[model samples]
Target chain A: MSWQLTEQDLPDLARGAAVLGTGGGGDPYVGQLLARQAIREHGPITVLDPDELDDDTLVIPTAQMGAPTVVHEKLPRGSEPVDALRALEKHLGRAADATMPIECGGINSMIPLVVAARTRLPVVDADGMGRAFPELQMETFGVYGVPGSPMAIAGERGETTVIDTGADNKHMEWLARGVTVRLGGVAHIAEYAMTGAQVKRTAVPRTLTLALTIGRAIRQARERNADPIAALAEALSHTLYAHLRVLFRGKISDVERRTEAGFARGRATAQSFDGQHELELRFQNENLVALVDGTVRCVVPDLVCVLESEQAEPITTETLRYGQRVTVVGISTPALMRTPEALAVFGPAAFGLPYTFTPVEEAAVGTTA
Target chain B: MSWQLTEQDLPDLARGAAVLGTGGGGDPYVGQLLARQAIREHGPITVLDPDELDDDTLVIPTAQMGAPTVVHEKLPRGSEPVDALRALEKHLGRAADATMPIECGGINSMIPLVVAARTRLPVVDADGMGRAFPELQMETFGVYGVPGSPMAIAGERGETTVIDTGADNKHMEWLARGVTVRLGGVAHIAEYAMTGAQVKRTAVPRTLTLALTIGRAIRQARERNADPIAALAEALSHTLYAHLRVLFRGKISDVERRTEAGFARGRATAQSFDGQHELELRFQNENLVALVDGTVRCVVPDLVCVLESEQAEPITTETLRYGQRVTVVGISTPALMRTPEALAVFGPAAFGLPYTFTPVEEAAVGTTA
Candidate 1:
């Protein structure tokens, strides 16, 4: 169903998108501010149901590309996403019928809403990745044969680059990452331009609504003084991410994080209150794998998310620090993201993890309840 | 006036371009081979005098961008320059009326000829830089208010990127350089699209003819058993680069060069045959400064060219090695290139050298005869 996303919706969207980010995709708070400011200036944006989109509707997905740590400090000018959309429109020689999120996670989810608000184009209720992955080519749209170019990238200073490397999505990612680094470690990009029919077939549908639901559930649970993590799990049970489990409830003991090559890459270790068990989380922008006592319990395209222990607020990878009480949660990814072709693009092996693909549900079986 | 650049002319062009390259631009022999193959397959190209161009003529300059060392080993597929031109033309929405060299030095001088031969577009006899400089924004075209983008870069794999970063040439260069590195250390680019009037007003004119003259003089001098160095100096006397002086005649005793950040950069030291003086040449892709016995003898916006002591063959920075008999030559840059405006972009200080902008002639005035 079509809906309108006003300034009031940004908080829930950002919070939910943070959960979907799996500990990357940039800070949701910053995204919320940018989106709220954009909506205040340009009015609420219409959110179009992907199913209702005409087959020929030109849909372009917008996102921010860079290290979350950098984005946190170097806030965008708030016009980069729209500037990128306009540049892409100029390159494609067509006006976009609607805009969408390439990744329905963190700042990326908010970026398309900003574009839609500024352009008065509806945003499709769908995204290429139901949850975020660091690289551009990890999108379900790319896996299903959508070219990542002619992609447009815009910097804070109104500089724009249009990349049209034919059919090599990985090459596009490599080139775009390099450009992002040159643009002060952050850039807004509009890419994977697709028709509505392609979006309907390949995109993870209703991810925006799913994020809103998760965010709303967490808020309501906190308001009622109930367990927010349980509410978050209850919210996911009704969505494509049908399985959610707390892999570890502990205080962060160590975080070996560094920003390198435009990514916030590192591993964090958490120790249980009893000091008897340990959990390690590895991430490159987004959390990629989780190991409980050296046994793999979660691997991407599954989601390994770290949340505040009581309030269930998502903690981005960049914000992970020593001595934080947190709950590490693992949620099964959408079935569409676990297919062999999709897994080949973003599986544990793709991230150099020497492990076979296993659902978070299966990996979590017989672990701590 | 216009002239046909046949396959027979390529040797002279490459040789002259090597001298003009000022020790960078990629190896001239590789460029000669690429141009020769293109001409043999497609036909000779027309070299149009810049003055003959109509005001409305849309001209684009083409060149290779990367470390000369990389180009030597990973020879282009010979279609990259043309691919870049076509991509730029598509972006600009106008077919090019002519093509030109962005730099009339090194392999870049031959790159435009390749594009022209394949596309059947006349190659302009003028170039942005009469002699090579390492960075893109160092061009006279840019210094004199020409934008370097709406540019196109193409990889050997037929991948292409179009950068249209409004009026920020340095930003354009930064983005393009990053893209070049990601494209495996070498790329072909078409940039600085200008009108014929802009070309006639800003470009260093008749550089192709000058390269040809230098090449012919050296070749004929060798044939007649004459001193090629003296012949080379005689050749420069008639061109825009009217002052040429041999700074040092020595054996290369020490060389420190490495390919880094998509550029061939380092220093080479040559000791005089008498062992009384030392000449140090510092280069980044192209030679930028020459210091003789700790005194500045040359600085860029001028040419510091290294040549074989006897044969007078230009030796690129990448080929500098220990124990090679060589002569270092310093030639004055064009008057247009030494203006206060031009110096601000490519002067010694721009390269982090602590020196004032002194012409090569003035710097060499008190040196040994």
Candidate 2:
């Protein structure tokens, strides 16, 4: 399937991507603006389905890397992603026939759209991580043994570094993260360059359109005065994500959050509006685990999304504030993420939770909001 | 003015380079061992005078960047410098005609030797910094107009990064430093690629031979039971460093050092044996300022070297310990470093000291150890 994305679609797409961002990736507003500006100047971008890619097609994945706190303050110069892509192409001696989002969350999801618009390069409707993970190595591409170099990192003011640290993705992330802090807290990073064959094998397909659909569902439900949370759940059920549940409807009770190690981490507690059960959210850049009344309700690789109670707008971790009425929703992650191999990388153990992860379907089987 | 460096010279050269290293650049023992191993396998490395270069020769300066703590733990695989050099050559579409040390201190001074031995390429007898400075932009090459990229950095395990940050040396340092930490705390870096014309224009010429002379003087004085300080001063006078004086002779009473921002930085205080006076040495990678009883003594770009009183063995900042008897020597920096432009980058004020820098010749004229 091929779809053309218009400037009008950016808002819905960004909103839904933020919901999927799970708390990190910075706000998608700047990314939306950049994408719209590029599309306005370069015309609408054609979004290609992963199956549309010829096996020989070269695909490059790109996203911003750094502290979300920094990326929000210092928006990119818009040319950084393009600069990084060109640098990679020059190194590889072949042009990237198509571009893909490294992750389908927050600013990163929209950034590939910006690049696709500017370059007139069609974007594949897929992503490495079906949802954003704090570190680059936590992606499905890495889970499938894709190397993270010769990756290129581009600074806002023409600083570009292309590195190949062999198969060591953790080292690449460490190096890239440090450089991102030095490059004014955020930098555009393009890596995991793979052929179309590898793309089909490693990528979580249909994530772009999935993000748009998720966004449109919430938006339409709000306009029609329907239950947006239920709408969002229904929308996700039709996609690669099936298990969905509203874990809590509450007003904030207590919040503990600290931004460190290039990530915003800590826990948020939401007591029910009835002053009963409370949901505890533990996050590292994103909400990783959620517990209700000391029972593990949802864990990593199972989507734990927070949203405004009334408008249903997604609330990223950075914007989680005190006393706001919100709803916590849980969705099952993609099939690729459920594997023990993938779990080993982005699983609950990776985040140092006391209890191991249980599938959202199994955990939320009989639970009700 | 040209010489061949054999394995026999590694000890004296490493010692002398460590003295010039000020307090950072890591211990040169590992560098010397690697250089010696490369030379033992590939024969000797020929040293070329800067004046011997053809106008069209391509000269690339190589060094190591990271925390000394990390570097001390993770040793290089000996081939990283060569890999970085080859990567740079491939990027530039031209082979490096010759190599040079970016700084004539610690591991940096010996790394080019390793590369020269392996590649059988002659090393230019000059360096960018007459001594080490923590940041890349503090070098004379950058203080003049040479760009710091298209530079290359290589990891010990077949990882390589080539960048063209486009003449912004500070950003280059930030980007490189960030990557270095992720590269297991140490990475071989080759930067400031310049033409022979630019090299002659910006490099502190003959610093390699100067290191050899300084090394030979201290070693011979030790063998004959002569005053190595006086011999070192005499040898310095025979070169561009005419002003040399022993500033202090004391036992280190207090040493406050911390590794921060990828640099080993802190201050060391030495109290005189007779309790007559005390000297304070403040450093950022290299000793930047020396104060005698709250009066500014010698400031960068003047060399402030700490040495063992009995053996004249250089004591790097990481090795500075409490209650060790040591002598401090002050030597004038290169003429290139004395210019207003260069001084603007390395003077006392640049290091956040109270007063402007006074030349070592004027400051130490009437003072005696």
Candidate 3:
């Protein structure tokens, strides 16, 4: 948790962020390039302890909510977070001293850094959710009652939107993505304004540290020619090292997409070395769950990620198509994600699937048996 | 604009709300019953002029956001909106002087009456949007920059959620629906805190008046054995109407529904007129557009309503199915809907159709050409 972010941290952050993205966080490269660009512009971010802020010090947590594929092609206005942050400060009559990631996967991790550098606010070493999720309320913060709005979305059009609804964080996620769709799929959002007291109470504290550590593990594993999955397990405290089933490392056989109420909804059918398996992933802003063979194998709050086996690179939900070889991997949902509230948000029933939640590893083990 | 409500007004409000629902919005029956129950519980709602309130008065708009189909089967935990509104008032440190509909169609119309009677607040003669939309941010207030959070959602589980994220209203919709999906597709939301000044300047003032009038027209037409469509045209200042070919009118052939990212993304195929023609309506929360003969007949922001011809009853999106002889009518998109913003949100392209915004009259007028 004490590890400082160095220039060497980017690769790991990107990988871990992708894995954590659960499949819907836009392309990690966009987030990576932005983070790298911000780091290059403002120097490496000084990760602060969650408890380091003064009681009155203001903090802003930021993220991106939209179609991940759209994000890579459209790019951000770059000034969105800064504009949103400034608008928020103006509304609140104070300036945020630090910025934090709303979620630390994919574009969200980098978006906070961009905002921090642009506004000259220090980046916090914490995030709301340890991993990525589809809706705003899916964050660990929501389980702890940290609201997501009265926050702002800054668009490239130089407009800043603030939503103060009587709904919860997930409502904010819906509203924000609607704007993102109108804004052409990438909207920089700065939300979850809190004092140090509230931040410590609700946030997934040291999430940035976890992200960094996980990032480091992946990078080191690659460098050492060791198994990256084992490295990830070593980093996560409660996680156990498990053998992976190269479920299907083959081209996507079919893809069906429908843009409904802003989130892209669809499934991808893939033909791997093992034969044909349909990988159905539902998403909002992040991948919520994946159904293989009409069985809920991985549900949200859990990471259902698709990576290129050859390069170990991340594949976003939007880019998933037929004829693209993808290695399907299942990572255990974090403990923070196992809470009853969290399950209710991203579990099988949450997405209207009839099956109840059984952890991915246990379910996979059961299936194999 | 200064129309007052009487007991006789309820019939129109119910009928009008259904027409405005555009094939979504839960059954008007529950909402009607709730409104009637509220009126019976506490006399008629005092319909106040939008200008009656002081500029500084706090006003909260509220509604139920979830699957319309679920609303009927699962009766509300009646006390949720009351709890949420009260909680929101407590958070704002003020008693709201009035309540209003976020949108004026379907469940939204009846909700304000219930809240008004429950909380003893006057129901404003206005709303954020003129008609029902699929998402929270599609309201006029949103386009005019009304915040959607610091809102509360009270669940039947005896939980109250207060969200204050910096996301846009669209994100608020996405996230709130996620909560609804989590809570079994129904959440009472209290959002859009506005002053009398903000409400007057930004909100579509007196749209509820229009809804009431539209409701009256339908009722009157039914009573007099006149054409309800003609009455609707007269009531809403609508200039365009298209009597298109009734492509199909039978039973529901099939229904495929999946809750993807909080919104119901599915298509309902219906067989009609002795199975001579087939009809398909794709929906998120509201049916955005309808395609008959592979041609876009009616796009959203306009009315694509299906009325049961024999009974002249408004058919909801949820209840639409095969074996139902539905008279599909096309109403022109309102002037507000033709704006670039409106087109972007619910226009043809928004519905993934390959046509520009054209009135149903014009679009269908050319079909015979």
Candidate 4:
């Protein structure tokens, strides 16, 4: 089914996308403002189902690439993504049938919405990553053999660069990262142009609709004076992420963070009220691994999300401050993302974590109970 | 006014280009090999006079960009410049009628010739900078109102990037420099796409012919046992760079050099035979300022060249070694390039030097004597 994503849906979409962000993809609030302003000016955007498109349809995924910490301070001019889209279109000499999120997380999820609203192109209700990972090549589209170029990157003042390289996706990321750093640590990019059939085969379908459902659940729970964390878990119970575990409920004790090489790299530590239980989360943009009291409870290819203890509002890596009350949650990733081939691209070892790939269900069993 | 540039002209062209390089623009020997091989494979290239071009003729300038030190080790595959040219042509939907050197210095002077040979485009007998400077914006085309983009850059492995920015030329250099570093410290670029009228208005005219004359003068001087340095000055006396002075004749005492931020930057000191006079040459790829006994003898937008004291062969910055006997020369730049408008872009202060713009003639007066 198709749907119209109006101004009313932005708040819920942002909240839900942030949850899926798993502590990366930049702050959703900033992206929400850009998307809302674009929607108000250009009218609502249409969200198309991945299955509804013909195989020949061209789909371009658009996102923000840079440190989340920097994106917070250097607000985009709100036209960079559209500029990138137009540049790519000009280079290809063909208009994109639709735009989609490269990753369904925080700002990236909203970026495609902003581009779609401005360009009057429908956004597909799917994404390359159902839950965000840090690097470009970690996406299913890349892992499944789709090239990330010819990619277009745009800066705030209308400076645009189009890269068409014979290099692999990793090299593309390296090249684009260098450009992003030169563009003041942030850039809007449109890449991984794919046909509809490729999208259907490689993308995490229904993630956009899934985000809206999760957002609605959290909102409804908060309205009824119920537990939002429980609502969030319940929302995931019927979806692809069927296993949800609250890894730790506590206040942030410490955060050692720095913006280096165009990424927000750091670790955050959360301690229980009694200080007996501790959880350490390591990240490079998105949370890669979670260790609970020296035991590897959750690792990448799975979600390690931190949300406010009460309201269940998600906390981005950039916003993980000391003394903040939070509930760390671990959710199982979709089956498609957990396959051997998929894990090879984004699994625990891919992030230099020493642990092997373990399902969130198996990893969280005794501890959550 | 036009001529055929065969493999036979390469040695002379390279030698003259090295003189004009003013101690930068990569090693001419490497470029000579590439151009010679290209000419051998693709036949002789036609050198076109700027005045003969139709007003609407598209003339693209090509050059090698990176620290000259790196280019010595990472020889290009001889195809990057043509790749960049083709990519730019594809982007603009127009074929280039001719190719020209962005600078008439060292490897860059030979780059366009190589492109012209491979692509069958005529080589323009002109250049943006008659003498090389380190940065991209220090060119007559940029100083006199031509934009440096839409520019195309190509790496050795066929990776191509096209930049179209609303930012000024300096920012474009910054953006492109970052890409160059990621492309392994060297890239072939085609930029400053100008019409024949613009080329005629802004580019330094007849520089290709001037370089060949300089080379011939040195070769004949060496063969006749005449003073090569005197021959070099005589060669320049008939050209735009008419004022020439041998600033210092000495053995190199010390060199403080390092590659940083994608540039080979350093200072070299030379002491006269009697050890009574010392000259310090400050360079960032190309010699920028020369101080004889702590007094400014010559600064940029003028030519500050270093050559073997005996042979008069140009010595690039990377090749400047301790104990080498050398003669430093200063020559006046073309009057067009010495204008206040041009000075604002490539003058002393533009390079963050404390001195003001003084014609090399006036600055060198009484110093050499």
Cα-lDDT of candidate 4? 0.91
lDDT of 3 by residue, A1-369 (tens): 323465567777777777677666667767777777776777767677888867777788877777665666787756777877876676566788888888877778778877766666788877877677656776666677767667676667565555554446665666566555656666777778888887777777676666666667767788899876556666765432132333335667777776666566676666655665556666665666666666777665566677766555667777776677777766675566677887787666777667777677765653321
* Tens digit per residue, CA lDDT, model 4, B171-285: 8899999999999999999999999999999999999998898888999899999999899888889998898887888999999889998999999999998889999999999
| Each candidate's DockQ | 0.88, 0.77, 0.04, 0.87
Task: Specify the poorest-scoring 10-residue window by lDDT in model 1 chain A.
Answer: A360-369
In candidate 3, which residue ranges exceed 4 Å CA deviation?
Answer: A1-369, B1-12, B37-43, B50-60, B78-97, B135-305, B309-311, B325-369
Task: Give the alpha-carbon lDDT of every model.
Answer: 0.91, 0.85, 0.69, 0.91
Q: State residue B16's C-alpha deviation in candidate 4, in Å.
A: 1.1
Clashing pairs in 4: none
lDDT of 2 by residue, B292-363 (tens): 887777888888888889988888887889999999888887678988888887777677777777888888
Q: How close to the true structure is residue A244 of candidate 1, measured as C-alpha lDDT?
A: 97
Give the per-residue lDDT of model 1 (tens digit) for A66-164: 999899999987889989998999988998999999999889889888888878999999998889999999999989999898899999989899987
lDDT of 2 by residue, A210-273 (tens): 8899999999998999999888888887888887787888987777877577777788898887
Question: Docking category for candidate 2?
Answer: medium
Which has the greatest DockQ? 1
Q: List residue ranges in candidate 1 displaced over 4 A.
A: none
Accuracy of chain B in candidate 1 (TM-score): 0.98
Candidate 4, residue B168: how far the Cα is off, in Å:
2.0
What tens digits encode model 3's per-residue C-alpha lDDT throughout B1-369?
334455567877888788778777766768888888877777777887788777987889888888776776788746778877886786677888888988877888888888987777888888776668777777767666677866677666555545555446665665566556656678788999899888877676676677677777777888898987666666655422223323334556677776565565678776655556566777776777766656776677767777777645778777766567667666664465567876776566765767777667665553321
TM-score-wise, the better of 2 and 4 is 4
- lDDT by residue (tens digit), candidate 4, A75-105: 9878999999989989999999999999998
State, as a TM-score between 0 and 1, how close model 2 is to the true structure.
Answer: 0.95
Query: lDDT, candidate 1, residue A39?
Result: 91
- Badly placed stretches (over 4 Å) of model 2 are B69-74
